[model samples]
Target: MVNKKPSSQPYNLLPEAAQTLLALMHAQGEVARLSEREQLFSSLLDSVNAVLWAFDWESRQVLYVSPAYERIFGRPAGLLLADFNEWRDSIYPDDLDYAERSLAEVLVKGAVEDREYRIIAADGKIRWLSDKCFINQQTDNNQRVIIVGMAEDITEKKQLEGELQRLATTDALTQSSNRRHFFDCAHHAFATARLDQAPLTFLLLDIDDFKQINDTYGHQEGDYVLQRIADTGKAVLRRGDLFGRIGGEEFAAVFPGCTPQIAQQIAERLQREIQRLSFSHEHQTFGVTVSQGLTGITDADESLDSLFARADAAMYQAKRQGKNQIVSG
Candidate 1:
């Protein structure tokens, strides 16, 4: 048995002190966990090659920026966070409106994914970036937070896609519209002509004595002649006309809203233009000539194939008659 002395403090006070100490220890543990998490996040920021950032909805101010900004854009992360307008102004002018509209759409929709834009770097280089982001609302419901978005460079990919599209629609030799592209435009023109009851004409042209020229001057000279013919033909045609290299030594033109008489005149003019062109290669100078076949759209019952066949027959007639003239069908 122990002798007990009367104490002023209640027994509950001792338990409360112990509880406070435990609570303090738990808080310290949480701080340590948070510190470790921050360090991990920083490491992640440094490892990526893309720009990662977050912002506030109301101020449109950047709240966080990843270390990758320095590596890719040649600017410190702090500069971007200090003034987001600097970043906005640095964007390519052509892409600025699109970028702003996309951001606004995302803010309204509460999320944005796979938006692409072009940003100017500190080194004065334009870079295409693809961004993905999420929106977070504040607990008090008065403000909104935008989560960190990652932006990856995609300039090279976009350029390659553009080049591929150009190649698909362009002729490799003449640098004009290809056969398929020509047909596509012709189809549209045909549809329009049928709707408006307008006349449409086609000219099928063949290089007169092309094989003989190739045999005499070599294939290189033949190619030069063909290119010159294409150039001259384009120069003489109107803006609305479509011309294309359809075959080895054959070309075609689609003239929309042209009657049979006008088509005949155009074919004759093209024939004269080709005859007037004087080409020289390796000390040899010679004039080029072409035979053209003209056909006009008469009725809705006419098909593109049938019209083309008539033009081809007329061209063959020109070839049979002389080899440097226009035949109308």
Candidate 2:
């Protein structure tokens, strides 16, 4: 068997121009593939109502932006890439530092869950956006790369949440804080007063003969009386004082940094005001009155239950003595 020698010409050799053209072809193919992927992604994003973006970590330059950018940001995607800092500059001044810090923390930590911020659009409209991003750690180098974020408009949802919170904490009838919310606030006030050694007083009031009023004048008139009492109480109270409708015809007020004497004065004033109010329904005029009980936190017992019990006892005492009077315990 004869062993043949290999040819002198380089076995893998091709013409220089052909190789160059081949390299160019491969590059073009890659670019076409990427363009197709981007188009598909853009179409997907456009189908829904969300903004998508990608930024190169090293250059801090925007690499890809979905069409929704124009809808949300009111600017062409090209403009965002043209000036890398444009997007950052559009953040609200109050949120700029916080947004930057949050982004930096996520970049350092290699992932981000969700964050909310306000952005100024090209049309000068301020919009709230919730952004979510994740870092791509399986890169060829140690260079940190973060997947650009997706932002969704959450203004309506946030507004609804605020409204719900208000409804939960406020009394529907009198528009004052409800019993549940008042309890929470009073607990905090008690804690603060205990810590500061400041005097704290509470006033528990009930409309005298409320059941009789409801039966005589009808329930609507009774409701009107309650509303009137709430308004008058609010008007006379200081700014830091807390008042709430605890139950039907029953109201409570928490006075932090107030002594029992001051609370009694305020209670007396409220009693006088209620007696002065005259309600006319269907050409019939009637007078309304409230019995008030006042109690201060004492060294014997510091619990809310104890304080409330004392106040309640005092209120019942007032009711027993007379329909309209202030009793202190």
The numbered model that scores best in TM-score is 2
Estimate, for each residue in 169-260, the C-alpha lDDT of model 2 and write its tens digit: 99999999999999999999988988898999988999999999999999999999999999989977888999999999999999999999
lDDT of each: 0.84, 0.86
lDDT, residue 136, candidate 2: 65
Record all residue pairs in model 2 with backbone atoms less than 3 Å apart, i.e. clashing.
none
The per-residue C-alpha lDDT of model 1 at residue 230 equals: 87
- Global lDDT of model 1: 0.84
* Clash count for each candidate, listed in order shown: 0, 0
Off by over 4 Å in 1: 1-47, 67-97, 117-127, 145-148, 195-199, 256-269, 301-303
**Candidate 1: residue 3 Cα off by (Å):** 39
Tell me the TM-score of each prediction against the true structure.
0.72, 0.75
Task: For candidate 1, list the clashing residue pairs, or say none.
Answer: none
